[model samples]
Target: MPAPNPACASNKTEPSMLADSIDALLPQTQCRKCGFNGCLPYAEAIARGEADIDRCPPGGDAGIAKLAELLGIAAKPLNPAYGIERPRLLAIIDEDACIGCTKCLPPCPTDAILGASKHMHTIIADLCTGCELCIAPCPVACIAMVPAPNLTWTETDADRARLRHLAKQQRLTKLEAEKAERLQRQKQLLSKAKSAKNQD
Candidate 1:
């Protein structure tokens, strides 16, 4: 038997636990403004001391403060290079101009966009995080950002976004695991064939 991987050992300062706590404090906008793939990745980076708390503009100064307090570090100002705090916005699609190519669908972390290939896509206003992730993928440039109506981002919104983001992550993890299993099975089959050929 081999020794267990130290990284996987149970410990008081487990990276996953720290990351989870950090992730819970995030704004959950799934915006790359933090220069990360999503809030969870950013949280992991923070847990590993590889990222700073001020990089998340969606969280703003208040959010930074929360993270700093959680990590027992001094709060710093939001890094301008990342982005500035702004009013929450929602994506609006020009239905007529939309080519319905569905390029924007996968980039949406929240699955807020509703459409299929060759069909006009629309944003679910309540779920939109204004991450601007879907805009660049649109070939027709039909998407625009507009201030959310009578809706300000609150902790409740963040909680919802966190759930959606987590669900997306879980789905992706499952897909990757399935792919790896398929590859392993294929390799085993090839190895068995080679062994039989050598014995013949």
Candidate 2:
């Protein structure tokens, strides 16, 4: 797991009090089954009245009841459009089948899949949030989810996963910024070269 962020672990925000409370109740799967980026984004949307509270399939009917109680609204059934709640599943990679394509690495919010191009990949069982986002990207179909009846998402597990997800998001954002900066410099250098050539 990555470093801890109290804001993410506690789901307490200094701003957007309502959203923070809403997020605190969410399972923090970071699964994106809610159709938003993650639990926090979904909570923010709910705070803005832009989304329904029933989209969290990982949270199931019990989760919906908690949200409804929090919002003082009537509890509704889990929205089938998102997914049906079932036993928690953990992703496992078949090493023999994995082509080392490194396709599934980017989609994992928790950074659970570890691998390099032309090398086999593996899942970090404790770190994986079981988001299922990694399954579709595997060209070789080496990734699959198994029911983890013994490993339920306790608060600690969710907190750890949330921290990893937050850290990964931060890293990706920084890398994107660096890429954009490099591109800008390349553009400037090319323009300067054109001006210099024209003067000659």
Q: To one decimal, what is the Cα RMSD in angstroms of model 1 from the true structure?
A: 6.7
Please, what is the TM-score per model? 0.81, 0.89
- What are the root-mean-square deviations of the candidates from the true structure over C-alphas? 6.7, 6.8
What is the C-alpha RMSD, rounded to one decimal, of candidate 2?
6.8
**Candidate 1 ranges beyond 4 A from true positions:** 1-13, 176-200
Which stretches in model 2 have alpha-carbon errors above 4 Å?
A: 1-15
Range of the 10 consecutive residues with the lowest summed lDDT in candidate 1: 1-10
* Per-residue lDDT of model 2, residues 126-197, tens digit only: 888789999988898899999875667887887887788889999999999999999999999999999999
The most accurate candidate by TM-score is: 2
